[model samples]
Target: MSRTPEAPSAPPVDGARTTDSTGPDLAAPARRSRLVAVDAARGLALIGMIAVHILPVYDPETFEPTLQWTLFGGRAAALFALLAGLSLAFSSGGRTPHRGRALTATRAGLVVRALLIASAGLAINQVMPSPAPALGILVYYGAFFLLAVPLLGLRRRTLAGGVVVFAVLGPVLVHVLGPVLPEAAAVNPTVGSVLADPGAALAQVLLTGTYPAVPYLSYLCAGLVLGRTDLHDVAVRVRITLVGTVLALGAWFAYWVLVLQAGGYAQLTQHTPWLSEDQINEILVWGPSRDLPTSTWWWLLTSGPHSNTPVTLIMDLGTGLAVLGLFLLVARPNWLWTTLGAMGGRTLTLYSAHLLALAMTVHYDRPALWFAVHVAVAAAFAVLWQRWCGQGPLERGITAAVRGTRRLVLGAPSRTAASPRS
Candidate 1:
């Protein structure tokens, strides 16, 4: 929103944000079909992810709470997935494309893009050691985009119904099909290293067993459905976010409680009623399966099983909604949305920056202080982007690459640089 650019786009790895519980009010996703809250969540998520990734850059051995592999670790990416879903639905041309036309063409284009992005993720992980990202969000997101188009045409109620049914039966679907999926195994680096060939990361991305595949698509589809809601008004957006924030968090806590309290309440009941009563809870219990018939808890927590998964549904979804509340509380201040929103807008660029930062991390011999500094720095860069340039550099690049070609066909001039004083 600021017409004037602030400073350079790089963060000093040595800088640190005191984790002030009191940052400015932020934007909510529902407000922007672009899903402002979702973007804010992603911006925050990626920042946290970068911090954790760089934490190794700062401190190679001692992991920070932000980087911990518990329920917390998984939260950021889930937010990314859900927002991807929302973006897919939001970006759809209001109506689903008929059997032909650009929609058909877009589908083909998306597949290619997905592979392209997945390849990039693989290359980054293969090169970097500590933050070796096995299950990249873009790979799964591409798969989700393919599924989302058709669902957009489904009646809203049908969409909602399907989401619930699939979620309920998620455990069963995974049980039968998960073994073949790559991401499931990639869920943990321990298993991922066996199959991961950074050189062949793209192939692994396509593997049925890869992370961000089936069950992950479910989250994207759900987001697409949510995006269908015409909550454009600030008031309506606030109300929906307020309600969703409550439900998502409530469900998350409830899931945690059920898992913990099941000690006496018909052990393995979460699985018994679904996966098979005879299925032993331990192996059956295997990490929090966000798959079919695994457990209701999966939907609340993540689209995947928990393996020291840091980011939980509560954090991803909650932070998104709460950030929105903060924005509304501040009467939708421009800077509030633009800053966090900048990361979302420049997702691919920032994503690449993150990888580049990680490469720097590995190259720097895993310094903890530098990593934290970058986390803060990445965010500061985002603010700079919003103020200096309106659209994200990465988003701009991808849009140009994808749309520029089309524009050339129409005899339109190609636009490369974004406005500095955007």
Candidate 2:
């Protein structure tokens, strides 16, 4: 879910030092130069995700969507995935993608990292089981990383093209393939289930289940494009902000015009005769059930949270870019932002811990108190650990593994490689 920083001079992918050692010097002060904005954005995403997991999604009496659901429901995961792409880009080569053996080694390292994260997720699924407190994102992350391995060397323009392609086609694939494929058996898939019916598991992670990887490729490619840019430039940051705002507003406006002003809503109700008007409205507000009813193409026009349609993907992508751009504009050495940055830098540890804790407890009885406790403990732990140690425990272990894989594949570097600026 996250990695630690390296010196701004030359950060490697996954925070692996490509110098005489395989890790960073925890005592070094230069680590501050790593992008605080990126980390802060990641921290905010973590907070949003935690809130979504703990808070009530709808008001019991009003039957209206809760503020947390409105704000963070689908967007937090989008932001996290987008950041993951940025991390991949930063690690692989940033503005200049790696080639030859370097690229090969980078891909190898990524594969190892993906497997580790996915393995952890599968193991976690064993304990949490179906109807778990949270549908963990780690396993799907592995798929994302592996899918990205092939695209690591693409230029910024090409990656931007990739974003467009995936945004349109990925969801289309899901809509077409979802009904025919076997339905997913578990909400949180375990190793046993995956092994027993790999096809169904694959279908679930790729297209049917929550946070399907195929449609989500848009976010990853968008992040790749962002990472390939001069993020330090004020003009670039401003463009990101403007572009994001326009894209988000434009997508929403289009959805409204087509679905509401036009006949798209009428078509949805007509096609799904079993669902009442209230159920249709619920789908519009809270997202679809299992998968959006494929009875009508009109469903694609809706842009609700987790809808996984082109409209929803584009809107969420825009929202993610806006958040990242704003943070880039405002990030500083101040306490508030830096505290967030610290937490963001160790989300791999923090997020996993949160999931495990949720699995062990019944927080629904006192959701607000549990949410507060989760946030407080995560923030305090992150700040203190970041001050005392360089990388998170899980991040450190992953970094070491990735570095070893790189070393095995490419041998030692002749000179010290610079850290990436992610």
Candidate 3:
């Protein structure tokens, strides 16, 4: 049987982006693993992202299930970042020996695509500068792509160690260096408002999420490790899910106990009812923290958790099991599956369109109506575009661009390229 062409998949740069390499033990790819999880995860993330962006349609103050994401806590960007990390590992073909030239080219392609994703994100940013800035996960994911490529073939243990060290040190790294580095502090509202004075706006984008790359990348590496290792055992999957769930709850509770329920916390909560929500989210992400450095991000990222809130302690059980469920669901509901994938596949275009839609709201002062319209139009576009164009405009362009570049760089002129890497 002849094989048709595959679209070239680019490792998503900061989908929410990073890096370098120095250490190594050999590693290999798994003989049996299902990529459907990453795809399904990405598909799920895209759906949540749409919902998150559509929040203005409803009341921002309301925390409802449909609008609240369980995975990465509804952080569309984090989901993309985790997906990128997993895809990066999957693409490593972990078994193959690293070739400097070929890997360099692939890394280059990742860098280019990361920038494209970031650029798309920044384009979205032109509309919103602060609280709702369009650039979030894509910004980080794009940066991480460059940061992670060198370690692509590293052993699981080695990468895991890297994740741990970084997670432990990243906050102090962010705080100490934050004052001097305007970009790193951009994500911090107080600092951002201060820095937005005049010259800092352009420089702040890169700094939005600095040292925290460790926590952010942890999710990716976790996904990568899961993919690279033998995770198919029924028990192993359950164990991993259990670990994630426990960590998530511990993180949430720790924050609740240490911070919110704390005497000072109650005072602040009294002043602002929303403070609890914000702190709950922070506690959920960074886990329990004295304040800064010790913050063990509850879930590698709040966005993932925020966007896809797991209703139970073992919410990841839902994420892990959702894959099998989606497969089964798709088998029974092909159209729905295709629709989800189509939205994910065209994320770049949809991402940009989302910005335009958001801007429309801000500009017209009908932000509420615009938000709802954005959701309807974007979801409809995903369904219609897949049916009509088969791929989104920007998605198609990126696919062609990556494939052609791969041909030139890899020296394999296969008529078809691999599918687009998210």
Candidate 4:
């Protein structure tokens, strides 16, 4: 979600570094360096998302999901959400965090940015001509930002604790509350839906929609916690890698024990006699048949991708963290890593462009080729743009708008603070 560091930096609190805003500081050095590991992780996520959009999930010959789908799928989006939270932390004052007037300014900036993202998402949904709609994440991103506003001020420990609470409680809450909520149309929501059926749209975004904010907030909070940590430290990265892997693998093992081998599937079969093994495999690999199955509580047991169930949430969050840690571990001074990190830096531009490309009819004919083309174009453009322009077009535009808005909202006095608006 964050293009570049704009938030004011401060000393670390208990070894955790403080964060900065997304907009650039005019007085700051022109050749600003970014956190390579984080950017590389983000780049990896963006590519995975592109694969999800462009490549076939299932192989034509085998009717089984390709490695791309199995590897990326929900994990990519989870990484994106996690990175968004990290960006939020940076924007809010990093480890130290902002207080009083600075806090107010951060909140205002986030709100405005959320509005812009949501608006763009709606507009894209309306205009993009995909034969089958793409599940636009921009709207969900906007909601996540809005939801994160209130949680921005907390310390590292508190935020980490929140991750635990959200991981367990958020899914339970969704399971209990989601069914009663009004279901919106299955199609991607447009701006027209906001005007014509505001309630349904709101409900969908908050509860039932793809990438619903309620459950996905767990990833965001986890990333926020990670952001507060001393990401630059090798020990920290190692610890994160170990812990995240354990959590991820542990979740999978739990699911295997409780669902696959524990008669949960049998319970479902007893209830829905028409269910097939292929369908079950699809749920296992792709996600749940729907968001979840209401017929049996056993659905809550599996850690399938995008199930939005407790087990799956934990698994995805762990996998995301593990992937992030691995990226950080491998992120070093190299041409490949540098290029990938550059690509990650311009995610706003590349992601939006990728979506637009998907809407085009020509690209649909040969998705693998199109996927490769988009990646090359995005990577090349990112490297060149980072060298020449210093920021992607959309990144620059949004940061400028946010800076202007922050300045207006906070007035002249706030601008003179230790951290001036970029």
Candidate 5:
């Protein structure tokens, strides 16, 4: 979701009373500043995603999943979405939000940012070498931005309430209506698909794709609320961890009690002839099998990747929040955190490069080696690049375009350079 980190195009920062709870002094002039913890969290999520992509999750011999897959899988992308929301909050206004012309300029910047990210994602989809369509999150990220535009002005409390409602109801509504909606595009969306059947493409992006925007919006909204808080406050970080732990563990516990222990899976096994026992077992191990079967409503209780189920969304949200909280707590000016944050700050560029690398690699037989190589290369490039250039290439380009658009619309130059928020 932080695929395209877009900053506000130099909105006028009024000298309003700064709230200690919100951390930063918004009254200060706009400069290229970022929360290191947020970037570190994004970097960690990016690493997890790369591991999911390159490393073999399940053992070929034992058919048992690797620890990396078990830990990251859906959670990594969830973190990305959450961080994206946080970035949006900072860019829009941080604690003290913008009003009138400033708000309009911010909105225009977001629109431009979304268009750039979505276009890039579609272009990347064309060349991705994965046999199965890579559910690249870049396009979905654009949708997140577009949808979040309206919600930008809401107070933190309102955004928080929206998160609760969407987490519980969003996936449920998607499940109830998904069958009747237009069929989703295959694998990755393409420009041709967008041009030929715009309606279907919209449906896929909103309701039926791998990362359905409708349900995933909860993560974004929650991150927005968190961003409004003083991320620099130790108390705030602790609260985030506590709240996230509760949501995650509670969701998983409910799923276990209501589904497995309550005989939901058993009933599904007995009643569904289409899926064999082994197939069900595989789903339990791997996931809810991408887009889960529609034969039974019990699937809605599943907490699997791409299930788009209520529990899955809620659980992953918790996981993301917790990870972010931990990162914030540990985001000292240490070498380790700094190194990871460097990579995180440039996730858009690194993520694209990783996909390109995947497209070129013919053999994944030695997945661990490949994973190591990718991580090393990405980390090295990020560190070295940051030494010479503050921002990543793609990230800089996107930021420049958005800033230029903002300047044109607002009839003035922005006050700062591109602020990269992963």
Candidate 6:
């Protein structure tokens, strides 16, 4: 089954002042508005992920990819990852990176957050083991957070460079190392599996798993660059939208030229004799089988969803950026966007609940009905909770824990506030 990206942190509060003890307050009025837009975009990502999880990807009769499959697929996960990076950037110091003791505290807090999220994922994995209905992304998200720690201090240009390097090299590394590494013990690895063979578990999360952190760094770095920009400017938002559209189209064009136009598909058939032409096509439409066949280098040129090829990475990144830019452009202080922002703010809690609900319920029988039910319930809960309570229940707890960690590290009253819509 295809996997969707899980939510990360809660959206940061608006107009919260950051002191020296905390970080600098990056959320001015315009910045606050930008964050609300970010929340709306994240809300869309959350809804898209739910649709992917619940709805059919392929039409049963035709075996053709469904509309939901085409729209969500890997793109929703990419958006989640990009937003995660943006969240980190905002929390640390939007536009200006945190330094000294503040930086240390922020990193420490992030580590704590990573561990908590991973632990939750591990516990969930025990219930939803291999061949589970939905694969939990929380564990891999932990690794993503940990990997991002070192790069948090970097500026936009350097991070942008990192995006290119990771996009190109991550897949190459996977191709080289995938053949030698032991196959992952389970699709959704548990704590027991990790304890049994740490190396295999590490290998899976880093390289061989469905959502490997190495290749995903491209999305994170791209988001970091976006976070550093002056997002309040209309010119900046327009440029982002234009550049993102061009990048997405360009990547798709390159893939078409390289794979279909060139002899890349033929090369694939020649190399992987086990898979028939139809089977290969299925893999293209439905994503990889077990893992992408490393039988030929030509596989790198194909840009299927979750293929993690350079082209796929670039394309997904562009799409994610474009979505964010458009949301930012259209953001207004209105009821609709505010409600969406509220839902976005509670994603961590909501996504976790969603996974649990999937585990307990039989959603496949009537996926459309179930999808609607889940969205409506989640929306209602988010709206009510935002009205009654400021932060989400789980988000509030995580924030408290993160704040405590920061205080422990700084050995003082830590004033570093959470980033808006982070």
Summing lDDT over every window of 10 consecutive residues in candidate 4, give the lowest-scoring window: 1-10
lDDT of 4 by residue, 1-422 (tens): 00111111111122232336875443222112226767778888888887777778878898887888788878887888888888887777766778988888888988988888787788777876634336778877788889988988887788787787777777776678778877776456778777888898898887777677877788878877886776666788889888889988998999888878888778867765666877766777777644665666777776667777778778877888898888777777478877877888788778777777767766667888988998899999989998998877877777777788888877886446868768
Local distance difference test, each candidate: 0.46, 0.81, 0.47, 0.74, 0.76, 0.85
Highest lDDT: which candidate?
Answer: 6
Q: Clashes in each model (backbone N, CA, C under 3 Å)?
A: 49, 6, 70, 8, 0, 3
User: Model 6: per-residue lDDT, tens digit, 334-366?
Assistant: 888887887788888888888888887689799
Report clash pairs, candidate 4.
Answer: 6-21, 7-20, 7-21, 18-94, 18-95, 19-93, 19-94, 20-90
Number of the top candidate by TM-score?
A: 6
Worst 10 residues of 5 by lDDT: 1-10
lDDT of 2 by residue, 61-138 (tens): 999999988888788888888888888888887777789999999999999998998888888778883467787888
Per-residue lDDT of 18 in model 2 = 31
Q: In model 2, which runs have C-alpha deviations exceeding 4 angstroms?
A: 1-34, 413-422
Candidate 3 lDDT by residue in tens digits, 1-422: 00000112323211100122764322211111233334444555655555555443223466433334333333344446545655665555433424666666666666676666655545544455554533344444455555676667677787777655544454334434445654333442223343454234333433224213434555556556654554334556556555654654664565456454654344434544544656655544423222222123222223223222222112332243334333322332246555555565666677666655544446345544755665566668877976787767887776566656665777864555555445
Q: Order of all candidates by TM-score, from best down to worst?
A: 6, 2, 5, 4, 3, 1
- Answer with 2 or 3, whichever has the higher TM-score: 2
The alpha-carbon deviation from the true structure for residue 41 of candidate 1, after best TM-score superposition, in angstroms, is 3.3
> What's the TM-score of each model vs. the native?
0.63, 0.91, 0.64, 0.88, 0.88, 0.93
Clashing pairs in 6: 12-421, 22-415, 22-416
Give the poorly placed runs of model 6, Cα more than 4 Å off: 10-29, 413-422
Lowest lDDT 10-residue stretch of candidate 3: 1-10
Candidate 4 or 2, higher TM-score: 2
